[model samples]
Target: MIEILSPSEITRARATGALVGRILQTMRERTQVGTNLLEIDEWTKDMILEAGAKSCYVDYAPSFGDGPFGHWICTSVNDAVLHGMPRDQVLADGDLLTLDLAVILDGIASDAAISFVVGQERDPEDTALIETTRRALAAGIEAAGPDARLGDVSHAIGQVLSVAGYPINMDFGGHGIGTTMHQDPHVANDGRPGRGLRLRPGMLLALEPWIMVDTDELVTDPEDGWTLRSVTGARTAHIEHTIAITADGAEIMTLAPGASS
Candidate 1:
């Protein structure tokens, strides 16, 4: 369902967004070589409880997934991209990591993700993949404004990734988010402009642009049924943010307290 936030609801959304952003930033800082994925999930749980917020993913059970996620955060390392369930693997130097998080505070939910390299930089391809997703996310956000069609945002995002020589995957993308983590007005990574849902004030959207290095194909991990890794084992990256539509433009609600973006 599509949800438009009331003024009070928007205020609650800001708080929820802030919490998600802060937790992601903290997790990114704490991640390094030798850090366990499960430990990261524990940290997220502690912070979520301390803030009196609810996890949007811990009990999430969708058709595509195995069952309840049972994890506080999504940790995608190297080949893994989306819905990566925490595992026993320890991060290695130069591993490309993506952290996706969602939380509900005051009944409003916010979602965001970030991709970065761990320990050290190894391959230029990995760095480029991460940068492309980041740039695509920025382009998508820039295209979001009151009265703008969802296609405009998708077109902008797709143009960035396409020009950078990355294939767009439509299987999963951004969407409307409010009281729930996922909602209507599905926002694909690529689409024709001047089409799809029209933007309006008070509308909230989570714009994410993710890409695999070599192909658009994805293979779900059979064991966990949550992690989606590149079929080619090529490195991947993802960047996303929760934004609120406004009369004049889009307001990004999930930026960390001290983050310039």
Candidate 2:
């Protein structure tokens, strides 16, 4: 369903968005080589409970995933792109990590994700992949505004990833988000700018741009039943942010406290 949050609801959404951002930021900072993915999930759980916020995941059972996610955050590492269920694997230097999170605070929910390299080792290819997704997310946000066509956001994201020579995967993309996590008006990574739903004030969207290095195909890890990895085993990246359409333009509610726009 497409949900246009009321002004007061939007206010609560900001708080939810801020909590999501801060949790992600803290988790990223605390992560290091030898840090287990499960530990991240635990950390997220503690923070959410401490803040009296509800996890959008953890008990989430969707058709695409195994029943009950049972995790506070999604830890997608290296070739793993989306819906990565936290496991026992320890992080290694230069590992490309993506942390996706969503939570409800005061009955409002917001979602966001960030991809970064863990430890001191930096691979140029990994850096490029992360940068591409980040730029694509920015482009998508820039295309969103009152009265803007939803496809414009998709086009903007696709243009950036295409020019960077990455294959786009549309199986799972951005979507409307409000009181609950996922909502209507599915936002694909690529589409015709003039088509699809028109933007409206008070509408909230989670704009995520993700890509695989060599192929668009995805193969789910059989063991976890949630981790989506590249078919070619190439590295991948994802970046996302929850934004609110306003009278003037878009307001990115999920940015971390000290994060630069």
Candidate 3:
């Protein structure tokens, strides 16, 4: 569904977005070599419940994934990209980890993701992948504004990732997010400008740009029936943020309170 949030709803959305941002930030700060993915999930669950908010993912039963995600967040490792279910695995040095989160606070939902290296071992390729996704996400946000076509945002993201020599995957991309997570106005990572849905005030969008180092193909891991891995086993990175269109332009709601954009 395409939802144009009311003023009050938008206010609530900001709260939810802040919570999501803080949780992700906390997770990033606490994560290090030897940290377990399941531990991160547990921490996420505790934080959401403590804040009196609901997890958009726990009971999520989308067709693309197995019924009922039953997890608090997505933990994509080096080769994994999307829908990465938290497991018993422990993070190691040089591991590229992506944490994707969405939560509902006061009936409004906000979503965001961040990719970073696990420990002190920073591989140049891994750093580049994460930086590329971050740059692409910035480009997408820059292209978003009232009356701007969704394609423009997608094109901007594609231009950044493509120029960085990464392959884009169209199957899973950004989308409209509001009262519930994953709404309409599907925003692909790459598309032609001047096409697709037009932006409007009060519209919330999750603009994510993710890419594989070598190929666009993905393989679903049967172990959890949720994790999406690169076909060539290449490393991947994803960056996302929930944005709200306003009279002036787009405001990044998922940025942590007091954090610079």
Q: How high is the CA lDDT of each candidate model?
A: 0.94, 0.93, 0.94
Q: In lDDT terms, how accurate is model 1?
A: 0.94
**Backbone clashes (count) for model 3:** 0
Q: Which stretch of 10 consecutive residues in model 2 shows the poorest summed lDDT?
A: 252-261
lDDT of 1 at 135: 90
TM-score of 2: 0.99
List the candidate 3 regions with Cα displacement exceeding 4 Å: none
lDDT of 3 by residue, 64-137 (tens): 88779999999999999998999999999999999999999998999999999998998899989989899999
> What's the TM-score of every candidate structure?
0.99, 0.99, 0.98
What candidate 2 gets wrong by more than 4 Å, as runs, is none
| Candidate 2 lDDT for residue 128 | 89
Question: What stretches of model 1 exceed 4 Å from their correct place?
Answer: none
Error of 3 at 77 (Å): 0.7
Tens digit of lDDT per residue, candidate 1, span 62-126?
99999999999999999999999999999889988999999999899999999998997678898
List of clashing residue pairs for candidate 1: none
